[model samples]
Target: MSLARTFVGFSSTDINYYRLMTAWKANTNIDFDFVDCQLQNSINSENEVYIKKLCRERIGMASKFIQLIGQDTRHKYKYVRWEAEVAIEKGCTIIGVNLNAARKMEQDTCPPILRDIGAIFIPFSPYIIKYAIENYSMGPEDWYYYGNEIYKGLGYE
Candidate 1:
């Protein structure tokens, strides 16, 4: 059987993604990577090409794109928008998160723009995220997961 793909995006300010990611890593092995929104400033034009190329590489390899549907991820950052878009354009199935369960403050998941872009919103609780990561090849989670590994990937620790 072929493996299912899921690319997760998030709001820059949503600290919850980190915490929840910790829970997810503890629970399962998702074999995931992340794109950093805050560090795009230092990237030069040469790096930009490499980045976009990487986006293509990632989307090309992926079977689904998981959007975290954070407050600003879709609008504030250009790279993320491009990543999601390229992922979609590359025929990677798009999976949007149901923010109702992951976040507690504001309501709803999958922003209007994401909806306009044609992403499928999957209702996901923490437990569900864990389960999905484990069994994604079987059925496909194609949605949200908290990711603490981001900081580590960025050399934060």
Candidate 2:
């Protein structure tokens, strides 16, 4: 299958989790892969406009946006939330990966921009995430989450 062009949004505090995702893809044993479209390097300026301009360019290349929802994700207005906003504007399929391991969107942790938009939420597991990236499509529902039966089918308890 062709790799899905994906952009991931997350708070700076959760960078380690994002790194782990990269590790999952790098490991030959893991059944996870995607063409990541994140910025290659940090922009050398504090200018929000310049930063956002670079981010927008990257987001435009993605067909999917995976938001790593951490404790401060809702409060991170600087870039994390804005990235999701741009992804929505670009018509990317939104996938909210709960770092806290929630199968559904947690009202307390989800960012305002992703709440009403058509998106799917899943735990931070590589299997479920890969499954979403491969199988999910935006539909009429504002939010989507797989039932336990579906997770069980994916070998999740």
Candidate 3:
């Protein structure tokens, strides 16, 4: 099968995780064309508008939207939220991966908008991610959630 065209939504703090996923794509057959929107410096109003337009354009081209839900993600109310909102509006298959879920005892800390919309949340496992990208249906009833554990059609125990 061909790789899914994926747009990754994340904050600067999660750049390492983004890099790791990129490396996974290189080293393994988890085929995906990862797209990112990272700005190095602050921009004025005109530049900001252009960047937002560019981000929306790129996000609109994606088949899947993967959000790296770190603790600070919710606080990044500009780009991350805008990207996710655009993805949701464009009918992209949205998936939230909690970066701290593996070590943290609390529930997955996704953005409030995502959690409110009931977007599927999965662990940061490459196997599960690939499976989700390939198999997760874009229907409300297709997701499997057991209390704090959200399964994206991977049949996890």
Candidate 4:
């Protein structure tokens, strides 16, 4: 099956979790896959304008945007917040993956730009993430999250 073209955003400190997601995509045994819209390499230049330009190019290619929510994600305004803003401006569906494994949006960890904005929040697990990418869509609400039953169906919990 074809993979969804997705742009994922996170704080630089959370790169390891992002790498794990890439590993999930690479593992044939896992049912997760996506055409990652992140920059193939970290931008070496310290120029903010050049960096944002490249990030915009990548985010533009995606129909979905996933934010990896970690402890300090809410405070990072440079790229992570700007990236989410760009994704929203481009009309991409937002999916928040809590690195803490919270199945719902944690107001403490979620970036303010993402709050009350009709984004689906899920745990950082391959099964639930794959299911969200394949089946979930934004609905009109303050925010969205799957119930315990949905998680149970995915063998979570």
Q: Considering every candidate listed, which one attains the maximal lDDT?
A: 2
Model 2 error, position 97 (Å):
0.5
Candidate 2 lDDT over 29-140, as tens digits, reads 9989999998888779999999999999999999999999999999999899889889998999999999999999899999978886779999999999999999999867
How good is model 1 by TM-score? 0.54
**What tens-digit string does per-residue lDDT give for candidate 3 at 1-157?**
6667788888879988988887887775654434433333445566767978878877877888888888888888778898999988988887888786542222446666676454566677676677667766565633332343444344455
Assess candidate 1 and give its lDDT.
Answer: 0.50
RMSD, one per candidate, in order: 9.7, 1.0, 4.8, 1.0
lDDT of 1 by residue, 18-95 (tens): 457545545546433333222223335667778677556656766666666665654545666777667667765555
In the range 88-117, model 4's lDDT, one tens digit per residue, is 999888999999989898989999888888
Report, for every candidate in turn, its global Cα lDDT versus the true structure. 0.50, 0.92, 0.70, 0.92
Better of 1 and 4 by lDDT: 4
TM per candidate: 0.54, 0.96, 0.75, 0.97
TM-score of 2: 0.96
Evaluation by TM-score, superior candidate among 2 and 3? 2
What is the Cα root-mean-square deviation between model 3 and the actual structure? 4.8
Task: Give the TM-score comparing model 4 with the true structure, all chains together.
Answer: 0.97
Reference-based lDDT, residue 116, model 3: 42
